[model samples]
Target: MGTPVAKIGLVPCSGEALPAGTVCRLACRRVLDTLMSGQTVAICLPLFIAGGEEERGFAARHPTITVDGCEKRCAAKATELFSGKPVRALLIPDILAQRGIPMPTRLRGFGAEEEAAVQAVAETIAQAVEGVVAQAQAQENQHGAV
Candidate 1:
């Protein structure tokens, strides 16, 4: 096989697409936008929905940023299982659960309240990534000045 390309990946778990809901996609986009503000996020497009070939392609390239819409945490688990420690992870259900936002059997996108929940999750993940980057930078600075 050829050497994997290096890119930044965005992954989301939407719990098997529903009739006409776009919560997962929208939330994923928000997360991507936030991450993109700090780093390059290669548009991998729905990594959790892809199959073996596509999955391998994504895993082979890009440091992954995974976002899951449920407790199942499919995106994060897949990232850990195949790709190793994801650069970033957002657990949507965990975030919502923490905020006492119950998941409806059928989601019709997020309301203002739910949107806040999603933003909180994404922001938390973004902050974590920023922290990691800061630590890496600190280490680099120390080494460079040595």
Candidate 2:
């Protein structure tokens, strides 16, 4: 059989109080469910923090990308603390600011602006996943050649 493919873990912030947090979750969902699909797996921040062995194990074994709502970087910090440093960390607010998109206000009242933010973030995550997978494959190939 062929070697197993590498999967990237996605850790999304669990801050429900902030609209950016909602964007983080939605964007991750898009990446996991559609954008990257089988290439990525979702790691629940709360479960990881609460000592979920499965979540921690996955992060430790695979490359992880953390998506934070704000500068607090709760997801990134937790993943680093429990497992190892994430391969890539993304901040929703920073992405929106860089794109000149305003921060979302209401969590429930999502509109075109929110959709745009989600699309941008999801695309970014998908790109990151591709990078991580490519790097992993390169390393595997190098080692196999030895």
Candidate 3:
């Protein structure tokens, strides 16, 4: 309720089905804290999907970045279904592949390598957040001019 619409919404995949899901969640937090700081807010995947209308309404009106744990893309799919718009989707495995890093297998504890992977995912998300903010600013500026 305290979250503001001006902040970019980060919807991380809530799939407990795999370790990749955990990766996305952790990476989302890292990006929010280090990269976005006060510029972003998280829309919990579980809550956003079946929680309340306020969240859905907020996502519909604001820019959202969906971080998917895998190809299923639960977060991205939910965002598009509820918000009626495509989000800036970042897939964790794909990010790692792009950097030529191997995917982690363990599901629980984040070891050194896992943490590094999370950082990589967070970095990619950070870059996307910058673009989202820039585009939002441009849209506001354009509307203000009109």
lDDT of each: 0.58, 0.87, 0.81
Error of 2 at 4 (Å): 6.1
Model 2 lowest lDDT segment of ten: 1-10
Question: Quick one: best TM-score, which candidate?
Answer: 2
* lDDT per residue as tens, model 1, 8-126: 56666655663112445565566567654545353343443455556656654655667776666777787777656676777766666787755444456456645655565666656
**Pick by lDDT: which candidate is best?**
2
- C-alpha-based local distance difference test score of model 3: 0.81
Q: Against the hidden reference, what TM-scores do the models get?
A: 0.63, 0.92, 0.88
TM-score of model 3 (CA atoms):
0.88
Worst 10 residues of 1 by lDDT: 1-10
Quote the positional error of residue 3 for candidate 3 in Å.
16
Residue range 53-135, candidate 3, lDDT tens digits: 87897788788889898888888888888885645888888999999877778787888978878888889999998887777
Q: Over all chains combined, what TM-score does candidate 1 have? A: 0.63
Question: Which portions of model 3 miss their true places by more than 4 Å?
Answer: 1-5, 144-146
